[model samples]
Target: MRTSSSALFGLGLVMAVDRLVFQPDRPISDVQQTLLGIVRRVART
Candidate 1:
């Protein structure tokens, strides 16, 4: 249903961000902010 799709979508986004964060060179604080914004947008959607 809608909730399951949302949960799956959030999980996919989290994993993508985790992989991106594991790579060299991105600043932690910037990543934090970006991830937070993405999460907020996902929730709003």
Candidate 2:
């Protein structure tokens, strides 16, 4: 069995978002926060 790069990237993205949301106490740097905001906006559309 083989997974495409896009599939792996999507899996990693889901995992990262899961960690960030479920672990609020984990401090995120300003850059990361900005990126997250961008991602959220893009996701909405």
Candidate 3:
């Protein structure tokens, strides 16, 4: 259940690319809101 530094770095890269990728139908605020919701849910568990 332990996460390594590389795994964390990879996750960060993925999230960064996900945020940087252009989407005509989606906005940055929506993406941020979704990420925040996920963080909140995980924090509750």
For candidate 1, the 10 contiguous residues with the lowest summed lDDT are 23-32
TM-score of 1: 0.48
By TM-score, how accurate is candidate 2? 0.43
Ranking by TM-score: 3, 1, 2
lDDT of 2 by residue, 1-45 (tens): 145456546755865786678866665564367556766775676
Indicate which candidate wins on TM-score: 3
How accurate locally is residue 4 in candidate 1, as Cα lDDT from 0 to 100? Answer: 59
User: Tens digit of lDDT per residue, candidate 3, span 1-45?
Assistant: 255455545655666687677554577678667666766675577
Note the clash tally of each candidate: 0, 0, 0
Q: List the residue pairs that clash in candidate 2.
A: none
**TM agreement with the true structure for every prediction:** 0.48, 0.43, 0.52
The lDDT of each candidate is: 0.70, 0.62, 0.64
Identify the runs in model 3 with alpha carbons over 4 angstroms from their true place.
1-12, 22-25
Q: Output candidate 2 Cα RMSD.
A: 8.3
Candidate 1 colliding pairs: none
